[model samples]
Target chain A: MRIGCGAGFSADRLDPAVDLARDGALDALVFECVGERTLAFGHRDRRADPQAGYNTLLQTRLRAVWPLTAASGCRIVTNMGAANPMAAGRAAIAVARECGLRGQSVAVVLGDDVTSLIDADTPLPLSGCNVGDVGRDMIGANAYIGADAILPALETDAGLVIGGRLADPSMFLALLRHRFGWDAADWPLLGAGTLTGHLMECGAQITGGYFADPGHKDVPDLAFVGYPIAEVRADGTVTITKLPQAGGMVTTATVKEQLLYEVHDPARYLTPDVSADFSGVQLTDHGGDRVGLRGASGTTRPETLKVTVAFDGGLLAEAEVSYAGRGAADRARLAAEIASTRLQRVHGVTEDLRTDLIGVRSLHAHADHGLPVAETDVRLRVAGRFESRERAEAVLWEVESLLCSGPAGGGGFRGRITPSIVTHDAFLPRGDVPTRIEVLTA
Target chain B: MSQTQTLPLRAIAHARAGDKGNTSNISLWVNDPAHFAAVREQVTADAVKRHFGAQVQGTVTRHEVPHLHGLNFVLTAALDGGVNGSLNLDGHGKSWSFILLDMQVKVETGTL
Candidate 1:
């Protein structure tokens, strides 16, 4: 069976995915979205509008690809439900009607949410930070669910499966297990499948989307980069390839790069389903765009599941202005100094205050600090995080007011203040977080 | 045909970077499998730590993938506080591979 990746994350480009669904014949199309911050923002959105917690791009993505998925009879699976899968499922059915699909089944997988299970008394695993620290600022909490939680939805023959907070790879792994009827005890097979899911979970990462470097590793037509497709056999052996006529090229270089993407210990890559070992894996170019994977094994799943607790982290403000032409570097530094001095005078010396001269020393600020640079143009930026929005706005206020007051040639001033949601990742025993699935037919 | 020369690691390898919380993982792939021994000898964890200097806050662990002709360097405390809390514009450090690939190495002429 073949499974195609549509959208990797919540805000993935939708058009190319349509190309994957329409052109690539597939049994399922999975969209792995709903990250930690996305769910936190989703919680805020839900509080603002009780019915608006799902992915904001869900409708646009579904509307674009549902027609093709319906025509191909390819099932849809996604974690775009974020904080609200039921609402997202209903919205998918609504889009199905708009796409002229009849008698389709949409399912919502439940029981991933553990917000109520976690309290101030709960101990946060993996870090010294305690759950009590989140206190009243806690916005949402979710456990990473797995393939077992998603299998029941597939049993109902649901055309669309919407889930919330499942592990990114689980969406693709569930489709593989259900299609191949792999046993839960099939450690090696499950390991191989998990590896496939991990490689495909990020969508275009394995398909030459992220592997391009101009002169050295050139990829053709990256503007229309294609999504990946995995051909999984019953034995769990898989060959990954993209659309034959797609814009990108799939090589061993691209495959190996993604093989270790987001992976910590190559021998013990943990997901909810199984502990996958990819240290001994090999990638073979089978001619054409297909790259074959071998030597993946799995052990028993982790006893504890990771839980991400999202909290209201107050406000983050940033402001920037560009300085160009003669003595631009000096002028940019002067602008930064003025903004920094003014901000300190008004807001006091805070550890959160960050000043950077883009194009001179931004990313590696400490290493590049005090290093002289001669640039024709540079952007001076000031950013900070504050406990209160009132204080956060001071950062932008100091930089924006610099156009006429500070530097001789600062232009294109821009500033913004937004509420920030920081996450504290912890873990609870798998038994403490039970997962189940609920199906809803259209 | 094996004259000694100094060149950037990018001449013989390419790399990609990914972040997990505060720790950053960079996998360097050798363009030619024959140069795997050279990469293994030169690109030690201590060398990587020194190269990063103050940018890396914790220890560096190297995992060798001989089958793929690759070396995975997991650098701890490299991303400040990662995406959730880092103030840097490139919080995820997605382009850090370029920085890593820029590290120079001594190699035989025409080996790359």
Candidate 2:
């Protein structure tokens, strides 16, 4: 099953590709541990830093990918963007048994930690209350699998692979369905290898940001943007390389905007297993750096079962203060609506407690769910809860100690607002969702 | 609690001819292409061909895989009326399970 995929992008820097699983030269690594590259929620001062400090994004991605996947030998599937993947897969098998590596084989793919099984109380078909009061608030909750269930746990010898909240193309389709044992009625070659793991799961947008195609070449200097692979060919056809003399520029508009990211329709392309058709995804020109995606079609696999629940729904806070010159972004949205009407007259919110401004809808993408704000700064995200978590952590620790003496300036409240809550647990759908097929390897 | 009591598959999801006609570009569950990539990343195919591309007027086709309905849409006609939105077949909401997560999986269990 020869599977491999790597990355450690931050948390105290040191991603020499997690030393390819400590020298075996590759097998597993996908540690984001938190998430980054979005800033500009008015540059800085959403009460001092709304996010960007989950301890430098997941402690430098689990101290450089759980000690190179517990000291290497390859076999990884990471969602590193954690919301607790079983305590991040038991801190990645306690750093592969504290890097002892002796008898390795980790497995923690808890079907994307369903934020406490849908709720208002728990009777949900389509949000009708009773998922025991739902709010599993998510700006992110990674958990993706489907390289045919991680190449048979990396061809039986498993090493280090812990996942919760997958879908970075299920870590590149569990390394091409564990090195091509590929089946499940081969829906258009597993929907063209699940759109080639959704076109190399976002690495340099298929190698040239925003699908760079204005006559192509020139942008190769993208300060070192590479990372997109796919040789695939159990007959589903693929070849989108990057690395070897890498840099940037895999063109065809970077595999059509990385197969149009959160994609909607370019011909059915869904993954987990076929429903991919990017209208016969055709990108021809395969010479120098290769780029071929002839005819892709997919569909098949529906027995209903896709749950992600996170519970405990309570205790949340918010704050922010920043507004640079010239009406500094509308006076920082009138000081975040005067500190949410002064925390709605001191913690009184109820329309079913939901707040926004998570880095401006995660960087310009939430207008309907709110956050169309424009200015120098705005992190007025306010949350309230009461069925008690100690009265929602004492009104979210007094909404983070009223960011520098409550609302609008205490000099635009700078640094110190860390208050992330998590004790939430939920993962519904415990039956009948198995198309049933087997094989393994990361 | 919902052990073995929800199975009535009906599917529809169209959006071809370069898209955008007022609306109509469905997909809720046409036998799983990853659940149509999670329902076209949540009801999109350009918002289902612009919201239902005038009930798929010209009629677009392609969907023949062994229907197992978690859902799949194009309502324009109401039940299966063709141009979209109509539901004629049978079954209307409430019964599906799609949670195919493969996080950091590389299982071989032995022979490495």
Candidate 3:
């Protein structure tokens, strides 16, 4: 069986997905879109507008790929439903109808949202705080559902399978499991399938998009990098490759980098499906952008399903001003000091305020040990978090004041205030969250 | 002792960083198997923690992937509260890999 990745993230390119659906001879196209913060924002979007919770590009993506998938009989599986799968399913149906595929069916997998199961007394493992003490408006909670939730939808043989918080790897694993008719207790096969899903989940990462370094690791024609495709056998061995005409090269290096991406313990990668062990995984480079992989194993699945609990985290205010020429770094440093003093003394907004000189030492300032070097250009940035808009705007107010009140050569001032959300990890019993599938036809 | 020289990890290895909540994981892979031992010897969890200093809070653990000649360093509380709450421009610490790659390691003069 062959599976292709259409998107690695919510905003991944559409043209590559279009390329895959049309020419890749794919049996299934998976779009894994939801991230921790994306889901939190999804809840906020849904609260504002009932139909706005799904991926903002759902219609555009579906329209571009639906026609091709319809023609090729390649099923589309995705978590583009985000905070609202039912609504996203309806949106997909609309896209199908618009694309002239009137009989296309979309299966929506529900029950990942477990907000009703949580309460004020619920504990958050990472924050060491209970829901009541978080001191912010609770948005919602979503359990990371696995293959079981998605399997039924795929079994329906719907043209589209959609869900919210579907575990990234499980989407691909479900397809492989269904195709191979593998038993749920087959740990080794599940492990291999999960490995395939993880490798393909990031799309172009394994295909050389993020693996490029001009002098060191050169990737050809990265501008038009291709997404990845996985060929899985019944025994769970797989080979990862991409379209021939597409850009980017897939070698052992790219494969190894992606294998451990976002992975903590190589021996214990805990997904809802199984605790996949990638430590012993072997990679063979078969010239022409094809890399063969095997030896991934797994133990039992985690008893509890991980959930992301989100809260309205007030506002994040950021303001910046640039300085250049002979004393650029000095001027930017002075601007930062001035902004810091004003935010603290005048505005009383010192809690989370931070200042940095971009060109000199912004990102690594916390750990910088190198000697200071002269810089011709520098931008001073001041950022803070506030509970109220008034306080948040104070951050911008102080930085903008530096133009006239202090510093020389301060120009190109820009400021923004964004509503933010904070998330923490929680776990729910697998039995507590039962999934149901609903099929809709255009 | 035989003649030895120092080179930045980037000269012999490549890395990619990823984040989960406030923790950041950087996987460093040596271009050649010959350099893997030199890298694994110097790039320990404690050395990495010191290399990062105050930038990372909490403990750092190094997981060895000998078969791939790679070392996975997991730094907890490394992202300054991670993507959601970090005020740093690179909240996800995606560039942290470069920071790790910038570390200088000792190698035999002719190892390259």
Highest TM-score among the candidates is held by which one? 3
Which residue runs does candidate 3 get wrong by more than 4 Å?
Answer: A369-372
- Fraction of true contacts kept, per model? 0.51, 0.00, 0.72
CA error at residue A45 for candidate 1, angstroms:
0.8
Instruction: Give me the chain B TM-score of candidate 1.
Output: 0.94
lDDT of 1 at A216: 94
The global Cα lDDT (0 to 1) of model 1 is: 0.85
| Best model per lDDT | 3
DockQ, all models: 0.59, 0.01, 0.80
Q: Candidate 1 on A1-442: residue-level lDDT in tens?
A: 8899998888888877998889888999999887777999998999898888899999998888888887888998999999988788888888888788778878898887788887787776545757896554788889999999999898887788898997988888888889888898787888989998999999999988878989999998898889999998877778999998787888999999998887877898999999999998878899789999888889988888988888887777889999998888899899888888877787774646788888787887655323357687799888887787776778888888888898788899998887777787888887888767766555
1 or 3: which has the higher TM-score? Answer: 3
Taking the candidates one at a time, how many backbone clashes does each contain?
0, 117, 0
lDDT for each residue of candidate 3 in A102-149, tens digit (9 for 90 to 100): 888999999999999999998887789888988888899999999999
TM-score of chain B of each: 0.94, 0.22, 0.97
Minimal lDDT window, size 10, model 1 chain A: A365-374
Rank candidates by TM-score, best first. 3, 1, 2
Per-residue alpha-carbon lDDT of candidate 2 for residues B10-103, written as tens digits (9 for 90 to 100): 2222111111112233333333343343343444334433433343343333232222222223322211221111111111211101101100
lDDT of 1 at B53: 79
Poorly placed runs, candidate 1 (over 4 Å): A134-136, A349-351, A366-374
